[model samples]
Target: MSIEAGKPAGLRERKKLETRIALGWAAIRLTVERGFDAVRVEDIAAEAGVSPRTFNNYFSSKAEAVAARHLDRARMIAEELRARPASEPLWEAVANAVMARFGLTQETRGAGTSDQQWITGLRLMMTEPALQGEFMKAGALAEFELAAAVAERTGTDVERDLYPRLVAGAVWAAITVVTDHWLHADPPVAIVPLLRDALHQLAAGLPVP
Candidate 1:
């Protein structure tokens, strides 16, 4: 779909979104079943019903496919922030948007056997060297996107100075802290509250509690 100035997206964009979702799910399922290291790019492409070339068009590597979920979350938050009321404070808008986008639902909280597998995969991602590198790259891309959004919202000059970068770095740092905590938390508490709390602390210019 075309995203012209001040215009809504079109059918093409919606179709592209569907394709991306299919590929993302296919990749996640494969990784969960066979473990990340065991999954091959050709197998993932076949599973997603796409050519290896098409898979490469969507993602650079198999690790990227598995990390797509997290990248999508950041993209969702950026989109939400961009759509928020113009008059709202930037930090409040960003925090609220992040929570709305990533907040867990009842099903996710009560996820049974699948939850264990999902958590295991996430733990593997955190500890595996290859996955960690992929994760960092995805995170850096997300930070740049987020910084652009914040610059637009706050009327800060993104290219000319360090303010925008500083804002982006602080936001990303807060998110990293929350993610690290969530990874280690035994009972798998909801991340929304942790993220919101962290953002709130940042907004207040105080240490995270």
Candidate 2:
């Protein structure tokens, strides 16, 4: 795993994480400032204060770099799920794991970057062709890791069993819905409550009203 739960990152790992984050933020910022087609990988690297070689080592394309945080956060959620108490119910564990990483409270909102920046970057992804593809790819990778973690917790086969995949898909769908709603919300409602409600509805089997 790139980052371990409950453990401090080593200096080397910390440096790598910093570099990845810098390149990612640079990619998004540049893409936002210029049109996506106008922002080259070289420009992203330059903005991040790294060479093109260093940028290539971390990401294959500018789109991937811009979408890196989504992948990273999903991985963190999987790790958080694995670290949850074994005795907890699966849905509860899943919800807690998601919130641990994605809850948009004051502390979490200010960590590393501002909430407005994240929201703007995500809205941009919806319209950018290359970035939309990369965002979907990132989502698929996140679903795969999340399914594996759920499978591990439930002693199910990630490839053969439907349960883990279903759970992962549901979680990902919920995230997508919440983010989309939050992005286009006429008045801009908070996301955490929506996330919690969505997960709760899923946990409750989505009964008819």
User: Which model scores highest in lDDT?
Assistant: 2
lDDT of 2: 0.86
lDDT by residue for model 1 over 1-209, one digit each (tens)? Answer: 11332456688777776666567666766676667788888888897678888888888888787777667767777788888999898889988888878743434223443655666766765776777788788888888777877888888877886877788889888888997888779888767788888889989997545
Which residue pairs in model 2 clash with each other? none
lDDT of each: 0.75, 0.86
What's the count of clashing pairs in each model shown?
A: 2, 0
In TM-score terms, candidate 2 sits at: 0.85
- Of candidate 2, the 10-residue stretch with the lowest lDDT total is 103-112
Mind giving the per-residue lDDT tens digits that candidate 2 earns over 1-209?
A: 36865688999999998898788778876776566888999998998899999999999888899888788889989999999999999999999999989944434233555667667755775798888899999999999999999999999999999999999999999999998999888776889899999999999998897
Model 2: runs farther than 4 Å from truth?
Answer: 4-10, 103-121
Ten residues in sequence with the least summed lDDT for candidate 1: 104-113
- Name model 1 segments beyond 4 Å from true: 1-6, 46-49, 103-113
Candidate 1 at residue 185, lDDT?
92
